[model samples]
Target: MGIKVNLDEMLHQRRMTLTELSGRVGISLTNLSILKNGRSKGIRFSTLSSICSELDCEPGDILARDHSSLEGED
Candidate 1:
């Protein structure tokens, strides 16, 4: 299975910049960049909560699961 963060798309859709989101969410720009670039291995609940609150979006809006490849791994 794999997880995908659609943050870039959402950011585009909302016409918001990374710097703006970082300030609004109170997360460091580097960390936010990592998340946006899908380089983050995990995310803290508090961070996720902050992002959701700031973006006014659900977790689903930012995250997605893909099980198709995993299904063939066995």
Candidate 2:
């Protein structure tokens, strides 16, 4: 299953930047970059909750199922 991180879209919609979010979430910019770039293997619930709270969204708004990856399954 492909888990897609839509941070860019959410940030755009929220009129926010990574650096701004990092401060508001109390997370480092580098670590946020890792998650924003989809390079992180996983994220803790507490972290996720913090992000969602700051973004004013639900977890589903950040992470989504990349159904495109399952297109060729038989």
Candidate 3:
């Protein structure tokens, strides 16, 4: 994937569990897991907003470009 989710790192740094984030964001564990595990195809901006709000982070803190994945592109 070209985009990497830094969710686990953020959660660890914040001393919070995924379950707690789910509750705070009002999102399901399964959905957050999909995102955390980098298995998601996409994310809704509202969902991203809610997560950022709870985690006290910017979108860049959660998402980053996988520069290695762009190695073959022009």
Ranking by TM-score: 3, 2, 1
Q: Report the C-alpha lDDT of model 2 over 1-74, residue by residue, as the tens digit.
A: 57889998999999999999999999999999999998888999999999999999999999998777776543
TM-score-wise, the better of 1 and 2 is 2
RMSD of each: 2.6, 3.0, 2.6
Per-residue lDDT for 40 in model 2?
87
**What TM value does model 3 have?**
0.90
After superposing candidate 1 on the true structure, give the runs of residues whose Cα lies further than 4 Å from its correct spot: 68-74
Which candidate, 1 or 3, would have the higher lDDT against the true structure?
Answer: 3
Which predicted model would earn the best TM-score?
A: 3
Candidate 2: residue 43 lDDT (0-100): 97
lDDT of 3 at 63: 99
Task: Itemize residue pairs with steric clashes in candidate 2.
Answer: none
| Tens-place lDDT digits, model 1, residues 1-74 | 67779898888888889899999988899999999887898999889888888778899999998665465442
Candidate 3: 10-residue stretch with minimal lDDT: 65-74
Candidate 1: give the clashing pairs.
none
Q: Residue 55 of candidate 1: its Cα lDDT?
A: 77
Evaluate all candidate structures by whole-model CA lDDT and list the values in order. Answer: 0.86, 0.93, 0.93
What lDDT, from 0 to 1, does candidate 2 have?
Answer: 0.93
What's the lDDT of the predicted structure labeled candidate 3?
0.93
